[model samples]
Target chain A: MLLPHWLFSDRAGLVLLAVLAVLGVGVPILNLWVPPDHPLYLSAYTVTVLGKYLCYALLAVSIDLVWGYMGILTLGHAAFFALGGYCLGMYLMRQIGARGVYGDPVLPDFMVFLNWSELPWYWHGFDHFGFAMLMVLVIPGLLAFVFGWFAFRSRVSGVYLSIITQALTYALMLAFFRNEMGFGGNNGLTDFKDLLGFSLQADGTRVVLFILSALALAGGYLLCRWLVSTRMGRVLVAIRDSEDRARFLGYRVERVKALVFTLSAMLAGVAGALYVPQVGIINPGEFAPLNSIEAVIWVAVGGRGTLVGAVIGAVLVNYAKTWLTGALPEVWLFALGGLFVTVTVLLPYGLIGLLQRREKAA
Target chain B: MSELVSELDAAGLHTPIEPVDATHGILLYLEEVTVSFDGFKAIDNLSLYIGDGELRCIIGPNGAGKTTMMDIITGKTKPDTGRVFFGQTIDLLKLDEPSIARIGIGRKFQRPTVIEPLTVLENLELAMSGAQRLDRLITARLTGEERDQIHAVLDQIGLTEHGGRLAGILAHGQKQWLEIGMLLMQKPRLLLVDEPVAGMTPAEMERTAELLRSLAGSHSVVVVEHDMGFVRSIADQVTVLHQGRVLAEGRLEDLQVDPMVIEVYLGAGDAYH
Candidate 1:
């Protein structure tokens, strides 16, 4: 039996998500079996591309929480993601001890080369993966809380709020890029030997990382889905439409905005932590303003208010980037810029939104 | 008449508002209230009291500070200097807008400000109760009791048959009634309605006056209106505001003949007849 329509009324959506997940998990296995010299043996590169896209999807979901629902368009999302990655990078560097080019057992090679005798006090407990993960979450959460507390309490919204967010990320980028900041200067931490005591180069480890990425994406989507379906979600929409009316209706509007913004930052942090391991690099470049803008474009091009659309947009955009960068490397940035303008001007509702419109009309 | 209907629809209509027995007890008490806007005293040294469940009409020409006075009471505008009390013990000055709303005080603006895009039923549903927290919002599924309360409000507002229709599509008179229905769902201890019949048809005006009269038994209502005939039909007492101060106060019949009231009305009495 084909099953009742209600039983699988959203069948197309379910099938699409399932197909993406299968493709995600299948790439690492293919990489293990295929020879490196064959034209079809591009599984390793595929894994790297998809893993990075999953990280972007996670960040996009975080942005949707604030901008799509709570009406907070944070341009500081890259800061939170960088903070999480830096935390993980700290742990990875500690594992390199004597193996580093400087061959200092008690210190990171950079510290040894720089002739630093001791680690910074903040870098103390990062040697443990558990503590590093905790730091990843806490560092971003605290920054978001403090930033939101001051900005929201002032009742800032609209363009003013967006400017402040941009300034926040810009400030962090400058701070992280400083040579004396002990965050690997501009280069950041890289060249990981192992994570959880498993060799990162092993196929089994790669497969496990791919599975984790899929799990993270699914979890992020579900969390956002639950949030936007609630009464709080309705209140958020109300705030977006008419803030003054929401206030008169008995909502503590500022508090609601702050709460959602902080939660969004924490989610971005987790995505950053995941991105560093799979990509095998973490740098101050991750905090660039353009990266944050790219995230907004992802959400906008996918369908701003739709949760699943963000993930689909992230994957599709990155997949297109892989093909274009290899074939038309010189014009890739132009194509990306042109695509954004086209989507904004003619496809404001995006692919998923267009589908929804068709469904409604039909 | 169409203008009146458009105005009525803008203001949102209501149920048969009944008066409470406490109408003679103690209604609204404001002491030494002062509000300023742009260095101009909107309400200067204003103090007023209303009896419980009483229907009182406030009349003032433009710039009389009538709207400012309502703003202070409903927590929209805070006074630079003054104290406001709800019932016997509630200190209204310290409460924010949502807190003030929770304490059984409802204010209807002169313009119909109902949630426009919601279905009539959904609008009523939103107004049925208050959710104090986001968790409450998450768990707020409509129960059978809530459904019954919503249906009763619809019945009283004469929108029972139009529940499924979008509130945005309602006729002017019907929209006004829907807004009134929203306030009714709160079952407020006191109701403040501004310009209740400004552009309403003769039929809508009569029905509204009748509705206010019916509401007089269970709830205390203070209506600010420019329509003397509408006020004469419903107001038990009248207060006249002028230049940000109370100029006169008494029964509608008494104010109708007062020289000060006549001056404020400014040859507009011919229309009332």
Candidate 2:
């Protein structure tokens, strides 16, 4: 297929693609082909964790699409991410059919535990993989469209928009925590068996999930890059810089914003859908405002407007988080806080920006 | 109001607007308009008109409602009373800023606002009148004809060599000229220019004056300028606004000597020379 010239011209994007290609090919080989006793063997735990990082990276890119390029600092993207996960989790719950502690074929363990007579109306169609996949995109997209339509139309922007987004996720977190909300309550959806007949616990399934995540991250990156490269992308940047100027130029500012916001939310949804199976659970904790803020920190630390920077930042920060949380559990939050403050005060443009500046200087 | 609705219905019935009804020779009309902010009237019962393809200059002291009048004409501010019309048929009051701009009225702000992060060429391309639909914008590529049009505008603005440069890096005068170039890309029949030469060097001001003069025959240009020399160089007819009303309207030479014009300027400690 023919690609636009701008896509090919992005050197950082090409580098990112090459790296994902290497991971896509290399991780599977090391995990499945290499002998388990060998020094080079990649463990399943490591594979699952790496897969989770790729999901986070995709989420970061989604945040960057709106915050970095469009100047909308979304603080509630985790809500979309959690909502997507819940949609897929519902399907996974149905996949548990007759295998739960209560052995209820029609309803999930939580619903059975709660004495529900039948599956809720909303969960009726999640059994089919295709429908679940469609919901992964649609649920988040519909929420974003409705939210953005009202917010952008009323011109709620800047820090106010960010605050409302945070409130949105916080509200979701509260609602999902309720035992009567039809989801798994505070514990969220878990105890999944398989997806599309492939056992999620099997090493081959794990490897495939990781590969899919890498692919999704790559796809998400390209979609965002393509969007920012087009004339519409310029319009987004124009809106970011001076909204009044864009309006005066005859562009429908609110429509453009709502469209991009919906697209970004859908992308975040894809990331979350891929996340649940690898992690073995989806919980209300994923809807925390802190998770959304952490995603923003990743974008800021990587480079705000650069798509590659989001990926790089997500992986790097999460790697540090893994190490810190494991080594000194109490210090992890402090370390994360320190890192954000340091990045904000010293490195405004982020790691990618610093690299670019050095290249210019050279 | 009924006429306004019928005009809108007629506009909806046809994709292309029947050329703005300038048959009576007036291209813009602001009749008995009033605007208030916090119980203070900014534009108090004002009426103004511009002839078809005419270049008009409006000069006034600070807080004399010069900018407010432009706001009303461009749909940025709605009057509490009275009607604003684009030619004889189109009611300007009913439209939003983007819709007003689409219907051949372009505005240049006082601060020379351009998308600083974009290249000069990109800025002009964005301001072009067509291809603003969401689908078109998503897949938009610069066609050969469009590129040629952008190049023509670059030359017109005397920024042909600077087309590839970021707009933010351009000098203040160049940024101003680039904004004017953006307005030109809109193909507006009426241009509302607010202080086009505020901080321009004499040479830059002379060029801007020439550009505005050249645009007069094909476009009705309403310039609100504070600089008397720049106004004198470009305007054939001038309107003096004081306390939100027309103090005087005539040739600059005639208005300069008017007792009321001098008193308004002098009382406000403003040097009109």
Candidate 3:
């Protein structure tokens, strides 16, 4: 029951954080170096699952920054994630070249098989990893900034803001599902070949991608921690507790909300970017509003306002989903719904919240 | 950005100082300020000033615009017309609520606004943190110095014993004091506290009045209170507002005898007057 004192002490805390960061880097490398059949080997399947979990943690951290701190509950964060994934996926698709099932050198397999003449106008320059990476961040950041600027300035909040956010994602999903829109319609962009220069299917590449994902998680966590620790962080907490009081104190409440919202969206985008390469697919299903709702559930299950809790919740919930879906596929939706109700009703802080309470009591 | 009239120190009646000054720092100022809501004048041509480090009481009837005046000064609601200033340099009308706050203006609503889910200590910490605009950068561990400040503020507010307790669990008076403690952490040069004794027992009222009086040396406090006895205990000067204007201004005794104040509040030859 005792967490290491280093986990809580300041100097020791940083040491522990460093250790955790090292372990984060270690996991993917461990998977790569140790033979797959070795007793300690986490297996490709395990690495993929855990890698995906780390990505989810990034998404949860993003949600926590807005919903937990700034008091802006976004139901559309998954859309940002999907946009990032699509951007990365586009690059991967470009790398496929003449290797696609349709054997087209320039067009992606979907476009070629569909007998399309060329790459869509919006798909330009995705062959460069740098441009794709830039798109991964910029696209989501811009969308969040514009949406948040309008919503926060208008004072849309609480349930209304959450509803509007959900509506936004749903709209994106519908648009992406349309075939003529050039996003591959219902099938989405797939059949990726490489990233930068590495073959996407190589285990070495997968392990490196996993390491990158872990590094991103650690970096995102540190960044969020730094933000909340600053004077600006306290202001976000204050805004979460009371908006009008914060506004009265002379904080540009709308600007603060917009900034936090956009930052959160970017984090989600990074998560999505990492997710795409590891999963080897990006689809319109990624933009499904329900996926975003699940992200919220992850935050709730872990702990609503606690960032670590959000991460923990995402891992725990998704891990359980993997097991439950495999074991009882027919009832998985019921289990998921039941889990939400049970967590929201009984364990409002989810598992992490419960642990925090116990720690406080101790 | 709207044009900000630097009328805060335009009268040159106030001298600039910290904590407390020679009654001239102009901690809070309003000149020809008018606040109208939907064609109805809530505060009309209101003009008032609270000197630096002065514990001034604003006593008025129900519709006296006392709360609205605080709103204007804190930049919660802009005046229909007029100048509002914090110190000699800053035009409050030019700022929004958060900017006014960063400029060291603190306001406590009549109701306690501490987050109930948070402990008293946590509430104070959140208040000091203000509003963070970044998400990915807000999760750093609390520093020792920040912890020390929270402890000091807790002790100063007499809530050291209750720091671990939830703010919602505190009595009304204690909650009020906790909010005041929260405002104190910002080390605000000026504090606008509305009705610090509204729902308190007499003992609580007395304690609160004592608390507000104690804050005088370190901060300029403008307390909007209807409790005359409480005002008498804390007010160095009292201003009575009516129909959105200053009806009377002076020491409590002087206002008690003002004919115009009597006419507005007491009516002619009232037994209380």
Candidate 4:
């Protein structure tokens, strides 16, 4: 069992994998085998929440791939996430055949309520789980490709690129909120039932989904880690440090940016797809510009340019967010803003950098 | 040797560049080129020819369009009017910066520009002449021969021991040499080096002069430098530019003594010396 040099050398990555493995295997046993009364028993609710955190962690990693490594501060990644959620949500909607309030066998509840006679052309393929899954990867990927092609080709970068990405998610939020867009308006696509013949509400299904989320995070981390370790990864760093130098080196800078952006978006889509089932909702609200910015804050707090830092940051921030929002809901937004400012000013390299410095000092 | 050529060919080392046609003895041709910025001419009716394997020094006062000229040749700036050609067939104006670079023109900026976060070896590797296509880049591993080439460049640039060190940590002179090493990795047909010895110590400048002189016959080297002493040490031919046009073209000795050249440029101050 000789490990590849990249995996062998990565201490943080190994630790991340070990933690994920423990969670993936340990959570299920604790939830299923241990009785509810036992102190060691993990509730299904806790498992679902942990699964949601993994999904957020995956999304943060996706953002780091582009923002941390490629130097494209995309403040619109939530658009990809929401789009992926909507894709899976559509499938779930179809799965609710004759189970909705309107009891329409073919049309979803919203469509029946709106008096639409048939499914939209785009909604036709989502009925099939495989197609829905493919869309989960493709739709966000295609949008990123088209957007990045125009943006990078035109040489839109730095703060301008960031602003445009923010605008992108803002625009999507407005469109998705429209009832005429065919995605469930403000109410969004919810009221899902079973997936692949397994009820999402069941404890077994919940456990499996949590494991899958963990697996997805681990896989996404490895994929990004491998990519950044390659020569292409060096090219990306070169582009980030100096675009002109990369271009003058005869590397196609725009194409690389666009391709990496598309890949990052696809990763976000997978995170979102995993998210929808665990949370049992996919709505326009997910596309809020603040959600995208918060994802970037997670990357910054954990540490930019280190793949493992993103997961740590996302989980820690969301964990704090969960607690803070529960304990002092009025102060959550302020705390988040203060944290971002503090990280930017004091911990420019983020927590990983601080730890690395301490290790060197020791 | 043939196997090596084929290996490099498969690796796309020699694919993008059409062999430069310098049979007529000219490597680069810029004729009647004019570029303007906001109604002011940055380059005014500039006509220049670089002979094959020539070490030509371009000296000019500030606003004389020396940097602008390099920009035009490297496809960074589009000339409003005129013909720019690489060898005889490739119209340089038609290509973008990366394409221009791929087709064998490499430019070093006035300030040293290297990927500081990367190690010196990785910086050189990125600049190596080969398949920069996404698929190739993603899967690219250094062949023994490629590693050898990188080692050769490291030795050439005198950074062999520092290859593993992050480029950002290198001294000013070392970074300049590393940049030149990167250009060497490109295997460029023509090298456009701008102000290579601007802030270097006398010893570093001497080494840089020696390096540029050594690079001439193998690569057509056009050096734009301000330090007259440094320029005199390496320049075989000198082109003096003034107000976006060639003021004089001759040996440095002849240009230094030319009254018109002296009046506009050389007479500026002892600062140039």
Runs of candidate 1 with Cα error greater than 4 angstroms are A1-16, A34-42, A320-345, B1-24, B59-63, B109-125, B128-130, B161-179, B194-214, B224-236, B251-273
Return the TM-score for candidate 4, rounded to 2 decimals: 0.97
Inter-residue clash pairs, candidate 4: none
| Regions more than 4 Å wrong, model 2 | A1-3, B1-18, B270-272
Q: Candidate 1, residues A175-222: lDDT per residue as tens digits?
A: 888868888878888878888888777766766777677777777776
lDDT of 2 by residue, B31-79 (tens): 9989999998999888999999999999998999998898888767889
**Residue B25, model 2: Cα distance from true site in angstroms:** 1.0
Candidate 4 lDDT, A42-112, residue by residue in tens: 99899999999999999999999998999989999999999999999999999999999999999999999
User: In model 3, where do residues sit more than 4 Å from their true spots?
Assistant: A1-46, A112-122, A356-362, B1-29, B49-54, B85-90, B114-175, B181-189, B201-204, B214-220, B242-273
Among the numbered candidates, top TM-score falls to 4
Chain B TM-score for each model?
A: 0.87, 0.92, 0.86, 0.93
Model 2 chain B weakest lDDT span, ten residues long: B9-18
DockQ of 4: 0.75
lDDT of 3 by residue, B1-273 (tens): 111233433322221232323346676778999989998899999888777778888877778899999888876688889988766656777655665676587889988887676678767766664322234234545689888888988887888899999888999889999989988877788888988888899998887777888889678898888767777778768888898888888888888877888777755334333
